[model samples]
Target: MSDVGALGDPALEDALTGLARRRTVLVASDLDGALAEFTRDPADTVPAPGAMLALRGLARLPGTSVAVVSGRDAATLAELTGVRPGDPVALVGSHGAESSVAGVTAQRLDDGQRALLDELTTTVAELIERHRGARLERKRAAVAVHTRGLSDDAEQAALEEAVGLGEGRDDVRVLRGKSVVELSVSHADKGSALLALARVVGAESVFYSGDDVTDEDAFRVLPAADGHVTVKVGDGGTAAEHRVPSVGALVVVVRRLLALRSDLAPGAR
Candidate 1:
């Protein structure tokens, strides 16, 4: 990889330039902590000031596509991102269990999966009741136990108990994230969802950015090639090729990409 960092990486610009020339390109990102700062209450999160605008602008460009892949369910992801029906940007939620993009559908639960989800919900709800500040978030295909507002000891206790719910269960997929643990009934993940999206859109290149451990699934699947720009926002080890310190820094990088692509479009001399 290039020695340049994410904020002002000339190599990143080079990658963007190549993508602009490609027949199709996909610009996608995770919602929480990547586009928006993490809020104690997930419902209150919103994208950085011009994050959505830049994404929307990129989507409108010729041969370009943009999508948001989030852990939130499709409807809630749209609501939090200010994405309305008919919006150009596509959406994938529930860590790829749900989708609003063309040619991609949400995960369908069978009777067994539904029953498993219900059990997970009940267990997580009980954990929340005992954890005081912890909360349980119900999703379309998964149930998450969030410890964002809990004290240090309480958060640890809640996470430990929540994780135990998935132990010895071959059917359950347990995903641990920052201050949260999710137990999913479906086997879907961001990597598979992202690849499916790329195929449907016929994208020759893809740029994806994310901030959480769950996002590692997407990063690991994206080849470390020139046009496949993978970025990690915030800290911790990542499979992403580049790293940005904050959501604001990531926004700047995206806007830079938008400007570069715009310059290449057919127009005045």
Candidate 2:
């Protein structure tokens, strides 16, 4: 980790350079707050500054692969990221219930779990509807209670309600992100996603980038290989091997990876 500071570090390049050797490299990144920002402006949606270009450049690299692992569902991810379905890039959406890559399976909810999901979604939907600012993001397999621009009390109420909704389900897990309460059927963690994706690319080296609480699941599970570089954006206690201050920093690291990609066929990155 040389001279890269809080935004990124030298260790990332070391890991990326090694990844250039693989027959294929898999790079997984969280979409919102990582690849793009949440906003009303269509053009401003991608991560600030040159982030989009940086990621696009990385994807252009030969023998390197890209995956957008996001909480948002696959359809939404494709619409936002402009990755058409069946595109080379893999997508892990709805926690892990859906992966765009072939041969990958996600945890499926049983009938009992489905009933509980219906209950929770209905409960939160009704409760949040009373508030002017709250929004109910129904992900089916997972439910999110969002307090987007709501008052402090509303946020707290949502959290409390989510905790109540998650009652008595040892199989289900509730994770709190920067501004939302996420309840997903405990099929897979981000770490499991990373490990599984690594095999798909047969990556000898790994680089993981994300922001928020769920990302710790991936950071903590990085293989013990020296070439693995785990990057965490913003402030948090993460198991990542390195830290970058924000998504903008992640763009720089992607640029470095673009440079590191070895000679291979076009359209293979």
Candidate 3:
């Protein structure tokens, strides 16, 4: 795993500098492990000091856009991040199944999809009941089984059981992330959401970051040759071209980019 020193690498700084100079650019990141450190209780998670402030500042720059694209539901993401309605920093949640971006419509479940989600919710609740420390998080088009506090054995058991819930079901999409398994009736992913957001904002390049396996979808879709910057927050094999050791390191990167971009135009800072 790369250490925090990775932030000082000239290549990364050059990439960020180039990205800042784009005619239009999108700065997007995942909330949980990218902007915020993981908390014992998910509800307790908040952005690292000055992280959101930097993102909001970047959003105010000419031809620049900022977004928090996460697996969280839209309303909870908004409430937790303190981003109000019509805020410049866009929020895409439910792994792209939900959104607070102006031109992107919210997701609605059809009768069949709703029925499948309801059934999955009941089954997951029963499974969680059997596993002492497991928790269930319900979303607009999905349910997540959290095993954060479980023992190694218990966590494995709970995750296996959760994965089993989608077996033999083509209609279900199962995503396994750090001590959590999510089942969604919708197929939307971070890659699609990022692409759509870029199109809507007319972004010529993007800077995206995340620390989960699901974030790989977004990473794979970003082309490094296009001056797009993709960062992985922690230790793991990733499709992202650059790596920052922790949320704090990521905050440094954002602040640096904000400063560089601000320097591009007078009185913008």
Candidate 4:
């Protein structure tokens, strides 16, 4: 195993080792920018090298749970991550609004909620049409305006227009991420999703990593007293207790966790 100390933060390293020793632990992470590199086209994103293998390996360890919590829909996340049904790693998609867990589904939107989504979609679509480099991403329960290719002024204008549409709409929730603005009928956030997964799996501690503004929700929800590891993957303001420099560094973190768990397993050298 590589030196745990070299993983960057000593406290984070110690916390991860402690989690490895726990009887029940949850390792959850965001996909875009966390496990996968961010791309102009979200569909083009894939997991960093060895990331999926590490997650699957960690999940196979006794008493450990792994989950991918993402903003993409569950099916898309599964397809992109190559997660088949019955895989050890769980999937939470649409920023926690959807999941692959049995008997768990996103709450159905009421008629009014549906109308709000329609309005949001139409409004964002119009803005996208006006902006030369903007694009619209339609999800099962949400719609997003992507400004990755837009000029600074156009991106700001698109964001402002999108935000205006949701003004005082209690049923609608707006979320801002890296060069994107999303409106969702469901109010689920990564924090709620992570908490729910932890409760279902009876996790004594959870280690979550993310690299977007939305990831702060998960970071805030992790139990601080349990020494849960919250890692931010890139440069940004974050609530995560620890920060890794890039997706490459995140891969190392996962490998380090795997090594620590391997050492703690029975019959280890």
The TM-score that candidate 1 achieves is 0.95
Question: Can you give the lDDT of residue 202 in candidate 1?
Answer: 88
> Which candidate leads the pack in lDDT?
3
Best by TM-score: 3
lDDT of each: 0.86, 0.69, 0.89, 0.84
TM-scores vs. true structure, each candidate? 0.95, 0.84, 0.96, 0.92
By TM-score, the candidates rank as 3, 1, 4, 2
What does candidate 3's lDDT look like per residue over 93-120, in tens digits? Answer: 9988887777776678899999999999
lDDT (tens digit, per residue) of candidate 4 on 98-151: 887754456666888788778878878888787778888888689988888667
Clash totals for all models, in order? 0, 0, 0, 0
Writing each residue's lDDT as its tens digit, candidate 2 over 78-97 gives: 77677785566677887666
- Name every residue pair that clashes in candidate 2: none
lDDT of 4: 0.84
> Between which residue pairs do clashes occur in model 4?
none
Which regions in candidate 2 have their CA more than 4 angstroms from the true location? 1-8, 21-23, 40-53, 223-226, 262-269
RMSD to the true structure for each prediction, in A, is 1.9, 3.5, 1.7, 2.9
Worst 10 residues of 2 by lDDT: 1-10
